[model samples]
Target: MYRVWNFINNYSLLLVAGALIALIWANFDTHAYHHFVEYPLWFNDWIGGDFTRWANNYGEGFEKFEVGDVTKVLSVHYLVNDILMAFFFAIAAKEVWEAVILKEGSLRGKKAATPLIATLGGMLGPIAIYVGLAALMGSATFDAISRGWAIPSATDIAFAYLVGRVVFGAGHPAVRFLLLLAIADDAAGLIILAIFYPSGDLAPAWLLVSLGSAVGVFVLFNWLPRMMDRGDQLRPMSSWVRKYLSFWPYLLAGCASWFGFQEAGLHPALGLLPIVPTIPHADRAFGIFSEAEQYLTDLLNQIEHMLKHPVEVVLFFFGLLNAGVEFSSIGTPTWLVLAGLMIGKPLGVTIFGWIAARPLGLGLPSGMRALDLVVVGCVAAIGFTVSLFIASVAFDGNVVLNGIHVQDAAKMGALFSFAAAAVSIVVGKLLRVEKQHG
Candidate 1:
C-alpha cells in the first residue's frame, strides 16, 4: 500500500501537488477549472497560441483582443506548456548532454551497451502493444487514438529512480541499470517529440536560426575565450568571460533559439536544446543525474542550479494545466495506455533484456539478473511526467471519442501509472531481490 503523497514528495513534490489539485478541481467544477487553465495572460503576435487556433480548439467563446493585427493570445496554458516548459526541457537536455559527452559519462563504452538495447525494448514494446491492440479494436477505434502510441513509452526519470531505489535498494546494480535505461528512454522521448509531433506546419528554414544562434554563441562566448587564453597559465580571458559576461550570451542565444522553434512550427518547449551544448561545462561529471553535480563549478551546472527553483514552479504549473481530467473520460484510450505500460513494458524489458544479456554477448550489471529486469521494467512503467506531456501533445483538443474526451482519458492513464510503484515493490519481494544499501 504505497501512499500517493509519499511517492510524489521529493524533487517532483510540487508537480504532483499541482496535478492532484487539478484533478480535484476539474472533477468538482469542470467549467471553472478549464477557464482558469486557459485564461489569457497576453495577446501579442510575438509569442503565443494563434488566436484562430485557440478559438477553434476551445470552441469560439474565448474573447480575442486585436491591436491592429495582433493575432495571438498567450493563455496561461501556453505560458506554461509552450514557453516555461522550454526551461524544464533545457535542464533535461543538459543532463542528457553531460551524461553522453562528458568523460566518465554514464552512457559511454560497452558497459552501457546492454542498457541501451533494453531502452529500445522499453520503447518498441509500448508502441507495439498500444498500437497493435488498438488495431485489433477495429480501424475506427484505432483512428481516433492512434496518435497516442508514444505516451506509454515515456519513463518519468525522477519517479522511476525513486521506485528503483525502493525495489532494489540504493546500491543494487539493477538500480543503476534502471537509471541508465530511464535516461536513455528520456533521450529517445525527446527525439520522438521533435520528429513526430509538430506544433504547426513544417518550416525547416527557421531551424537555421536555432542552429546559427548555437554556432554564434559557441564561437563568441565559449570557444573564443578558450582560444584567446591558449598557452596562458593565467587563463585570464576565459576567467574574465566567466566572471563578467557570465551566462548572458548563452541566455540571449537560448531566447533566439526558442523563437526559432516557435516560428519553425516545432514544439517550442524543445527550443533551448541547441544552446545547451554551446555553454562551457566541466571536463567530467561526478555521476549522471547525481546530486554532486550541483557542486561542479562549470557554467552549465551553474545555469542549471540557477534555473532549478524556477523550473520546479514551472513544472507545478505545467501539471496544473495538463492533468485536469474527469473520471468519466476514462475509456478505451485509457485502458490501452495502461495496458501498454503495465503489461508491455515489463514483458518487453525482460525478454529483450535476456536476449541482450545472453545471445548478444552483452551482460547485465554485476549482481543484476534476468529477473531483475522485470522489476526494472515495473519501475520504468511509472510514466507520469513525460507521459502526461506527450498525451497533451498527442491529443490536444476537446475531441471526444465514445462520449469521452480522449486527452483527459490518456492523462488519467498516465496518472494511474503511479500504481506501477506498488507493483514494482511486490515484484521485488516475490523475486526475493537482495537489498543492497549504498
Candidate 2:
C-alpha cells in the first residue's frame, strides 16, 4: 500500500507515458492488445456483448428482479462514467481535500501558484476554446447535436504526469506543478460534469428521497467516530448508522443518491457530493492510530491513494475504447484527428492560460519559459477520456450532432489534442535548450 502511494506520489508525472502507449495501441496495436472497436451499432454492444445480456436478465423471475435496460449502446459509457468512475471521484475528492483542506496553509504562496493557476487555466482553457468554436464555426445544427461545451476542459492527469516526468524530469518544480495543475483541472471538469450533463426528467419525490439519503450520510459520517468510540454493540440507531458508515456503505448511499438525483431531474454528479465529503482521509495526519483502527483507516486511505494515478488505467480503457472506432468507415486517417489534438489544444491552452495569467502578478515557473508554457499547453491537448465521456453523456446516443457524428467528432478532437501536445513537447524541449545556450 505504501509502495503504491509512493509510486503515485513520486511518479504521478507518468500519465502521458501511459496515454502515449494507449495512443500507439489505438493506432497500431492489433497483434496482442485488445482495442475499442467502434461499431455502427450501439457502442454498448461493441464493448460488453454477452456481459450486458447477462446484466439485463440476471434477476428475471426473482421477487425484486430488476435488470438494467441494455437497448442503448451508450449504457456502457454510463457504467464507466457513473459507476466505475465514481471511485475515481472518491479518489479525486480525497486529493482535492488534501490540497485545499489538509495542506491548505502549507500549500499557499508563490510556490503553490502553479497548481492553482494551472488548474484555473485548464478550466478556462476548454470553455474558451469551445465557446470560441461555437462563435466562429458552430452551426445551429452542431450546437443542438453537440451539447457538450466542457469536454475539452479536462486534462488527462495521468498522461500529463507521465510526459512531465520522463521528458521533463521530476527535478523540475515547474513540471511537478504542471502535473498537479492537471489533476486540479480534472476536478474542475468533474464539477462541470455534475452541473451540465444531468439525466433528463425531474421528479419531486425522487428529489426528496435523494435529500433524505444525503442527510443520512451526513449524520452517519459525522457520528461514526463517536459510535466506534462508544461500543461495538449495534443499537436501534446503530443499524441505521451502520448503513451509512464504511466506505462501501457510503458508496452504496452515493449510488442511491445518484439514482434519486437522476430520477429527480438533477445531475447524477450530485449523488457524489455527499460521499465526497465523507471519503476517508485524516484531515489532520498528526498522530498514528492503533493497529485495529489503522486497518480501517487504511481501507479508506486506499480509495484516495489509487486515484492519484488514474491516468494509466483511464488511458488503457480509452485505448481499448478508441480501438473500437472503425477506421475504414470514417474516410480519414486517425492522424488527422491526432493533428488537431496536437495543434488546436495547445494553441487554445496557451492563449487562454497566458491571457489569464498575465493579468495577475504571477509569473511562470523559474525554468519554464513562454515556449515551455506552449509545450505544457500542448500536453493539455490529451483529452481522450474526458472528452469521450462528455460526448457520450451529452449526446445521449445521438451519433450525429449537426452534420458530424458526436462520437466521431469527440474522437477526432481527442486525437488532435494528443498529437498537438506530443509534437509541441518535443519542439518546446528543443527551444528550452537553445534558449539556455543563447
Candidate 3:
C-alpha cells in the first residue's frame, strides 16, 4: 500500500521521454526513424533476429552489409526488446514470485481473493470486447486483429500505480486493491505472452537446457551451501558463498536460460523467468512500489537493485523502438484497443469484483466502497507499458488492414491509453471518492 515517488518518477519519465521523442522523430522523418530502429549492430548465428528479416525490412542494400554467412542480425531494436528487456521481466517475475510464495506476500489468502477474482474480469472483459467488436466488423476483420485481444488485458504496473495514487490517494484501501490487481494481471499477461505468442517455431526439447541451468545453479549455489552448513550456527559456508560467489553463478545460469529460450523459439524477453525462483529471496515482500524494497538483503532483491538503473535505460530504448507509430496509422484496431481498455476493463472489474465480494463471501477492503471498484478499473485502464509490448508481439508489424498498418494502429492505441489517467481522475471526482492518506 506504500508508494515510492522517486521510483515512479525515474521509471516513467525516461519511458515517456523516449516515447515522446519517438513520436516526434517518426512523424518528422518516418523513413529515417524506421531505419534507426532496425539498425543492425551485430551479425552472427547465435543471437539476434534473422538476417532475412532485417534485409526484408531495410532493403536489398542490407544483404551486401552482411559479413560472413551469419544467420542473425542483432539490430538496435532486438537488443533492447529481446535481450536487455529480460532484466525488466525478471524484475516483474521477482515481485510476482514473492507475492505468490512468501508468507506475508500480498497475493495470498483471503485478502487476495477479491482482487484475484477481479483480475479475471479485468482480463476477460478486454478479450470479450476486443474480439466481439472485431467480430462485429466481420470475420475478415476479426481474423486480422483477434490475436491482439490480450493487449488490452495488460495493466502497466508503474503507470497504473502512479494513477491509482492520484485517484484513490496513497492511504486508500483501493490503492492496495489496485496494486494487487495489477500484479495479478501482470502474472497472467506473462503466461499469455509465453503460451500464445511464441517468437518462432516450437523446439520444446531446448527447454530442457533452461531447466538444467536453473536446477544446477540452485543446487550448487543455493540449496547445497545451506545443506553443508545445516547445523553450524555461524552458517560459515552459506556466508562464504553469499560473500564470495555472490550473483556470479546465477548470472551464468540466467544467460544459459535466456539462450535456451531463444533457441526454443519462445519470447526471449521472458527467458530470465526460470532462474528467478532459484535465486535466494527475502522472506517478506514490501511490494515493488515502495522505498522499503531497497533494504532487502536477499540475493534476488540485491540483483534487482543492481539492475534498477540498467532496467531504466532498457525501458527508454524499449519506448524509443516500440512507440514510433505515426498518427495517420490510427484505424479499427486502434479503436478496438481503446474500447477494450476504457470500456471493458471497468465493467468487467466491477461485475466480477462484486460477485467475489458479495456473492462469494469475500469483502472489500475496509473503507473501500463498491463504487470504488469503478475508479480502480479506470486507473487500471492506463495500460501503456505492457500493452505496447503485447501489441508488438500480437501481430506482424507488416500486417495491413484496409490499408491501415495494423501493428502501428495498435501501438497508437497503447500510446493513447495515457488518456485513461485523465479519465480516471474525472471519474474519481464524479464518483466523489473520499481521499485517504497515510
Candidate 4:
C-alpha cells in the first residue's frame, strides 16, 4: 500500500498517465468521451433551458446566480477547472510566495537576480512569439487566437522539474534555476488570468470585499499563534485549539474570496492567492518535502501536505475533461501554440539569460554555462497542464467572439507538449547533459 501510494504520488507519472488516457480515449470514442464530460450532475433544467427565454423574462444581470441557486448543476469540466483547480493554484501561489518573499528564499536578494530576469524573458518570449505569429498570419481569427497568448507562457513545473532531474541529474544548479524560473512563470500566468480573462463587467465592490476577507484571515493567522503561545485564555480554549483550528481562517478566507471573484467577474482560481503570502509558513531551508527537517507544524505546509494527493486526483479529472479534443480540429492556432512552446521557449530563455548575465551584470551560477541554460529553456517548454486550463478559458463557450473554433485547436496544441518533451530530451543529449544512473 505504501509503495503504491508513493508511485501514484509521483506527479510526473500521474500527469502523463492522465494525459495519455485522455488522448487515447478521445481518439478511440470521441462521442463517449464528450458524453462523459458534458453529463450534467445537477441543475439540469436551469442550465439546459433556453438562454433567450430566460434573458427576456429576467432581463440583463439575471444570469448571475443568487444564493438560492448555488446548487446549480455544472459539467465535469466546470467543476475541475473552476472549483477544484482553485486549490491547485493555491498550492502554486504558496510556492511562489515562499520563493519570492520569504527571507530565506532563492529570490530574497541578489542571489536569484539572474534566474528572476530569465523567468521574465521566458514568459515574454512565448507571448511575443505567439502574438507575432498571429499578426503575421493576418487571419480574421487572429484576435480570438491571440487571447490565448498566455497559454504557452506557463511552464508546468512538475513536468519540467522531473524531466530536468532525469536529464541533468540531481543537485545540478541548472535544475534549481529552472525551478525558480517555473515558479515565476506561474506567478505571471496567475496575474494574466485575473487581469485578462474576466467573464463579466468588473464589480469593484465585490473585489474589495474579497481582498478584505483575505486581510481578515491574515490578521487572524498572525494573532492566533501568539495568543495561544502566551496561554491567554480566549473563550476557555486550550493549546490544542490553536494547533488544530489555525487552518480554518484560510478556508473561510478562500471561500469568501472565491465568491468575491465570482461576483467581481474574474476567474476564481486566483481567489486564494492574496491570502497565501499571509499564511504562516515554516522556513523551507531544507526544501518543502525534506524528510530530514523536524516537523514544524506550519499551517501552509500542513495544508499543502494534506492537499497534494487530492490535487493529483483533480489534475487527472482535469485532463480527462479538457484534453479530449479531436485531432482533425488541429489548425493554425494549434500550430501557433506548438511553435511557441517548442521554438520560442528555448529562444526566449537563452536570449534573455544572455542579456541578464552580460548587460544586466547578473552572474550565472558556477558550473552552469550559457548552453546549459538553453537546454534548461527547452525543458521549460513543457506547458501541458496549465496550458490546457487556459485554453479552456480562452475559447470554450466563447464562439460568438472568437468566431473561430479554437477550443479544440488550442487543446490539441497543449497536448503537443509531449512533442516538446521529446525535443527537450534530444536537445539535452546534444548538449551532453549527463544522465544519472541509479
Best by TM-score: 3
Candidate 1 residue lDDT tens string, 1-438: 111222134447999999999999999998888878877777787889887767665554575444356778788889999889999888778878987997777898888898888889988898899999999999988999999999999999888988888888878889889988988899999999999988888899999999999999999988988999999989899999999999999989999999999889899999999999999999887544456766789999888878877888888888898999998888989999998999889987888888999999899888888889999999999999899999998986767888888998999999999999999999999999999887
- Which prediction has the highest lDDT against the true structure? 3
Question: In terms of TM-score, which candidate is stronger, 2 or 4?
Answer: 4
What TM-score do all the candidates reach, one by one?
0.96, 0.67, 0.98, 0.86
lDDT of 2 by residue, 154-268 (tens): 6766556556555555566546556657666766777777667665545658776666766686666645654654765645454444455446666667777776766666555
Q: 322, model 3: CA deviation in Å?
A: 0.5
Residue 271's lDDT within candidate 4 is 78
lDDT by residue (5-64, candidate 3, tens digit) is 365678899999999999999999988988899888998889998787777766535655
**Candidate 1 has what TM-score?**
0.96
Off by over 4 Å in 4: 1-9, 44-73, 224-240, 288-294, 398-404, 435-438
Candidate 4 per-residue lDDT over residues 1-438, each given as its tens digit: 001123123666667677788888878987677667655444533322223333332333445544244434455655677778899899788777877766888667887888888888888888888999898977666766878888888888778876777677766778778877887888888988899887456886889878898888766666565555675555333345446776787788888888788678788767777777777777763443344233557777777768878888888788777887777777888888888888888888999888888888888887687888888889999888889888887874434323445878887888887676677788888988865432
Q: How many clashes show up in model 2?
A: 27
Off by over 4 Å in 1: 1-9, 57-61, 64-69
lDDT of 4 at 282: 74
What C-alpha RMSD separates each model from the true structure? Answer: 3.0, 8.2, 1.1, 5.3
How good is model 3 by TM-score? Answer: 0.98
